[model samples]
Every structure is written in structure tokens, then in C-alpha cells.
Target: MFPSTEEGPEDDSAKHGGRVRTFPHERGNWATHVYLPYDAREEFMDLLDTLLFHAQTYVPRLVRMEAFHLSLSQSVVLRHHWIHPFVQALKDRMASCQRCVPRAPLCLSSPSPPRLPFLS
Candidate 1:
């Protein structure tokens, strides 16, 4: 899935890999969007992989995650007004995912209450 210098650019991917292989940064823009076209799966996966890679290697403090989906906590004002609905939506999504893809891999982390695994 990645380039190996020893294999050289002349290897199979050299001719087959599309334009993204030539300019990886172009994929970043698409990731920022709320929705992306299905055709962009490869690009999106590449972007996600890159994001996780940097988060793990550079920002190790975040306990970097590989799970793609994310849900932000509501703003304090909105939370007070719509906490129940927001929780329901989040629960529904999680339940649906759990049913549809049981045992699917996911990464969950809490940065504020950090768990130092190596400490023990």
C-alpha cells in the first residue's frame, strides 16, 4: 500500500497508480468536506491513513485513533436545550453500527482523563 524505495518507481505501481500518487496533498481538501463522493474512497482512505499516521507519530499524547467516524460534543448552550435528542442520535448511530457490523474494529479515547498504559 506504500512505496518502497528499494523496489524503485519502475515497479508495477509506477505506471498504474493514479494522479494522487503524484500529489498526495490534493487529497487533504476532500477530507475537510462534510460529504465526499463514493468515487473518492481511495483518496479518503489515503487521507484518513495519513491523518492517523501523523496523530500517532507526532501527537502521541492524543492516543491517536484509527476509527474514522467522529461525533463532537454539543456546545454548552445547545447541550442544555437539546441534550436528550443529541444523545439519542448518537446512541442510534452507535446501535445501528453495532448491529450492522458486529465486532468491527474501532478506536475510542479520552484525552482529558488520560490513561497512561505504560505507567503500570
Candidate 2:
């Protein structure tokens, strides 16, 4: 997950260019990745809340996520200029594909094309 605020000097995240890097950094390059967004059902939200309540007892700072997704690709680098075109191309390809619908909560449990609401 990406955070807007700086991790501070005590945080070693700033060392070696960044906390971790898949490829060498370049001035105009940007990191990119793909994922399947999920819209949790009411049942899942309830379950998550119950889990969070118990988890907060141990880790009080734990924050609830507004949304989450299943990562489909590892981090990849792209030129800043290519960002928009790359997204548009991905959207075009996805628009042509058929959507999958599975009753199970996790989409990765399904075959080939994942069964997720956003992918549709």
C-alpha cells in the first residue's frame, strides 16, 4: 500500500532509493501494477468488522480499509509519458473480455479470468 506521508528519518524506507525496488530507478519512470478490485458483500463487511474489533485489541492503530483488491501483477516500471496510454490500452483490452461471476468471496479461486465485480 502507498502512503501519502513520509515515513520519517527513523524509518529505513528511504535507504537504497526506496524500501524495495523491482527495477532500477529513472527520473521519468513510474511504478505500475495491476489488480482486481473487489466490492465486498454485506456479509464480508460484517465479518471484517468483527475480525477488526478483535484485532484492534492487540493492535489499536489498525485502520479499516475503504477498499481492497487482489494483486494480479508484480511491480513494473513505465515511463511517466506512457502512463495514460498504458491505462487506456489496458481498459480497451478489458472492455473486450467477458466478465466472470463466482459465488465465492475470493476471485483467484476461480479460473483464467478472475471473477470480480470491477473486472466486469
Candidate 3:
């Protein structure tokens, strides 16, 4: 990780901080790994809450998965020029990566019963 001009320790500056990490996981050839900067976790959660709240009423499965899930709806609030393009690009990327387009119905329902969050 290199440093950027904007913040924190030289090693933790924004430009360098925003860099994402990727590696091949030993678990499987198809399993690529990603590690987001630690500081971004909280911001991610904030955005997640906003997305979940906005999508909840429209997606019953979302309500069912409330305990743990990611709602891509937050992408809707990204720069106006980016919204549709980003989604389309994501779809294209997924299609190429998976080697086939998935035809299953979109479902957000949890596969298992909800579990309580661990709080300390």
C-alpha cells in the first residue's frame, strides 16, 4: 500500500487507502479474494443501511434478509450519470465472469432462519 496526499499516516493516505486488494484464494480456483480498507467498513455499513431501508418496502425478501445481506440499491444514488451505466456494466461484467447469464428469478429471501447479532 502506498500513501496518498490526503489523510492519516503516510501509509494510510486516501489515495493509497482507496486501493483495493485482490488475490487468488486457496479455497478454489474460482474464488478470488478482496479486502477493503478497514476504515471503509463503517462507511459501507452506513450506505448499506440506507440502501436496505429504501429497498425494504419494495422487496419482501429484503425484509427477510435484514439480519445479513447486501442491497445493491445503494448504487442507485451514485452520480446520476453513473446509475444506469454502472448497473448495466455490472450485469455485463457478471455475465462474462460467470460465462453464462443466470435465469433464476431474483430472490432476496434468506436461505436460513435469522440469527441474533453478536453484541458486546
Judged by lDDT, which candidate is best? 2
Q: On a 0 to 100 scale, what is the lDDT of residue 23 in model 3?
A: 31
Q: Which ten residues in a row have the lowest lDDT in candidate 1?
A: 27-36
| Position 15, candidate 3: lDDT | 55
lDDT by residue (tens digit), candidate 2, 47-111: 99999999999998676788877776656678999899878877887887788886665544434
lDDT of 1 by residue, 47-72 (tens): 77788778778766443233444323
After TM-score superposition, what is the CA distance of residue 24 in candidate 1 from its true location, in Å? 41
Error of 3 at 56 (Å): 26
TM-score each candidate. 0.22, 0.54, 0.22
Q: Which stretches of candidate 3 lie over 4 Å from their true place?
A: 1-65, 70-77, 99-120
Model 3 Cα lDDT, one tens digit per residue, 32-53:
1111222334665788778988
Task: Report the Cα lDDT for residue 2, model 2.
Answer: 44
Q: Could you list the CA RMSD of all candidates, in the order they appear? A: 20.1, 9.2, 17.2
Q: By TM-score, how accurate is candidate 3?
A: 0.22
lDDT of each: 0.40, 0.69, 0.40
Name the TM-score of candidate 1. 0.22
Cα lDDT over the full model 1: 0.40
Give the count of colliding residue pairs in each prediction.
Answer: 0, 0, 0
Q: After superposition, how far is residue 75 of candidate 3 from its true place, in Å?
A: 8.1
Model 1 bad stretches (over 4 Å):
1-42, 63-74, 78-120
